[model samples]
Target: MSPIEAPTIEPVSPERLAEASVWIAKLHGDARGRAIEEGLRRWLQAHPENARAFELATEVWDDSEQLRSVVPFRPLRHVEHRPRWGAMATALACMLALVIVGVFWLQNVGVVATAVGEQRQLVLEDGTRVFLNTDTRIVVKYDKEARRVELRRGEALFNVAKRHDWPFIVTAGDRQVKALGTSFVVRKDVERLAVTLVEGSVLVSPVLPTLPEQIQPTIDAPGSIEQTPVTTALEARKGAGEFKLAAGQRLTFDAGAVTKLDTPSIEKTTAWRRGQVILDDTPLQAAVIEMNRYNEAKLIVADPDAAALPINGLFQAGDSAHFANAVAQAYGLVVIERGNEIVLSGKPIQ
Candidate 1:
């Protein structure tokens, strides 16, 4: 009967949120429909909080999902051999961006991944398969009209199942990668987002701030981003996000640029999943991080100059002590572990 602690509320799980989305969408934009919701309804009501909560939700949806790429539900549309299709619309209202992404929402959706130093694989109800790299999580939130996932951290290899109605969308940090029909790899670190298209197309866009007043009355549907399109998706994705990738394309995005490299070989880039960090002239700092992932013994490079020095070779991870010794030997340096840090210097400490 009293006001609830609204702001202090922990965020709802995507699946639960998706269920609420279905309730709001089915309400058909009316007060009576809301009155009939779980709260206003009779003893048939399943959850007592559904009424007031659904009310606040309707406002959120109108302010968020009413004008954008809202679609009704279909499953696994992104990985189907064929293309996925959707009906999207935009409308300008007052000083707000009335963005609505209609979906055939599912009741439960979440993305999950393993903890640090752990790798995992998951299959969604739509049949899409996702391989989460070490310390990664994928969320799946579905509705009667749509399915989506939020990649929370680390990396993932996606083998999307086919669905024409419910396309699979992965929101990773500030970037949104849409898998319309594809198998691809996406890695997200605090500083960067890199994507490689293995077998299909994906639209990788940066998140942009919404300028409510900038909404035009025209049906300004942005272009469809695909994997093979050679346009400057990077520029198109600017402000909000950057770039896209088609099958076989490899793109690495930093804060400034999206570099489209040569076609990719999955086996080469993801060889770490097989237990080794494969480097082709990679930086020393990066190699050290890889070793740290699996090693308890610290590797501290006392000489900043030595760390920047370029080196290339395939070394077994278990032999980091040997590796450090080799690096020191090659650079005419010394390796020593004092306390928690291992120092590699140009002079022998022993």
Candidate 2:
């Protein structure tokens, strides 16, 4: 059976729209406060247009897919008495204008970012679920023909929903990883891009100079113009060295070349998802770097010998103090607490 079409909504007045925008922001901002909730309830009950306008504005906000870009609505500051309707209405109008502009901006570009010691899960308009790790940033662009994501920094895991006609591709640095109906993780660093496939398959290849023009949609003044459908399979195999990675396999790209292909332990590679950092004979320096990603206080290996020590353990993410203490006891190193920095140095041999 065909899906029923949703009825078209008439345009709401600017004043009403503005009020609705402010109400939505306040409600979202102070969801647990009873005062705001009761006030909003009374406001909605006072006028029929209030409810309709709020519903319309909310629908637009939900559909925009870029709520992060919008300026959050802040409650009005305390005043001597109740403000006049004219003043309220004027404030609402300005907010509504900003909402309109934000909606348009989000239509073309959407960005998601996470700070240190933070993780985020987001479902895209295409139904793909993305799990972003600490200090991660990604830009998503979806159009009629293709769905694309650029990993600007850090790491993310993609659980892509199947849409054979629309290819799912993630680009980081000079490499592109293409997948369909698969789950994979992409980590971007200063000099390398790593693609690890947990289930299904993916093609990891170098990004050609001309590839961007072929994949990105043509944009005009108002909106994007539909371009030719990107052929994922063909593009993966053309003009570059491509490595087909199966489940449990990983492909690392460095310096515009395929550096390595290995089958790493999936649990170890994805340990961050479970809020733990697992180290299996990892170098002390590298382990310190991993732990520091999750904490504000930095960990520093003060000696070359201490930095080269082998580390193996499973510890909660951001437990730098515990890690430092453990390492000091095990290796007989001195742990110097210097403000926010934890420095590990080898004990002097007597």
Candidate 3:
């Protein structure tokens, strides 16, 4: 009988090994979720070398005392309970800045915030540059082992610095993004989280908590309907597992746990970075929602007919009056100013 040949093990490249290292760290971090599990499964199955690389990385990560001792940052349990701002009228811009800086200094963490109609830029201690959009907030925590940021609310763009041993992670709600060094935009809205990769790859995974499966009514034997196990919006998202976004790709995770992946228009995605709101056949109502994020005056669409009208153009951010007037003129609607609110309705009968 021929002697059994030794198994051929494909060699893992340095890039694959680095990716494995990041994955190992994330697996041990607070960002572990069903999505991460599935992502790891896929990555391991993609190639034989991937499994070897992951095993090798795991061995190193386990043996390194520094890696094991790195404590993950826990989000603040206390949320600031304050009256919601109808506009940017809560406080003066300068006053808000002072208050934010005080909080940062006292907490020993970098807290960057932007009120309505305001934007700011900052360079973190790790050389990461962040561009905060209007009405945004982010808390940065950097330790000897890792760099992390908690996006409490709003949107921001991150230009992460390269640190192979120290991974950069951003956590928003129940989802998180992991990167070594890359440029990406992260937006946390009321019920959604969106991430757009600009120049490098990033891992987008949900945090803990596997959303429960939903139940649906299905017809049984006769005419009676019975409850059946069904996948929810979030379950579908969980099924997609963790997302590995490429440059120019976008991912949106809704509060309901639904996920959408697309290669959007980079120009449109980064328009806000240039202080412009670019709309491409957007509905009047949706346009108002986007415009309101950066303006002091609230825009309300009072008429359903007018709200359904399509708007297409590039407009300045925070210029609610200009956006309202342009939409009204194009759709022949009426724009009425009521104190700080701009109401758009159907034109009155002549």
Among these predicted structures, which one has the highest TM-score?
2
Pairs that collide in candidate 3 are: 234-257
**Candidate No. with top lDDT:** 2
Q: lDDT value for candidate 3?
A: 0.68
Regions of model 1 farther than 4 Å from truth: 1-107, 208-244, 257-265, 294-298, 315-322, 338-340, 347-350
Q: lDDT of each structure?
A: 0.55, 0.71, 0.68
Q: What is the lDDT of residue 258 in candidate 2?
A: 46
Q: Select the stronger candidate by lDDT from 1 and 3.
A: 3
**Per-residue alpha-carbon lDDT of candidate 2 for residues 266-350, written as tens digits (9 for 90 to 100):** 9889888766788888888999999999998999998887776778777778788878877777777888999999999875222
Give the 10-residue window scoring lowest on summed lDDT in candidate 2: 67-76
Per-model TM-score versus the true fold: 0.56, 0.62, 0.61
Q: What TM-score would you give candidate 3 relative to the actual structure?
A: 0.61
Ranking of all predicted structures according to TM-score, beginning with the best and ending with the worst: 2, 3, 1
> What local lDDT does model 1 show for residue 167?
72
Predict model 1's lDDT versus the native. Answer: 0.55
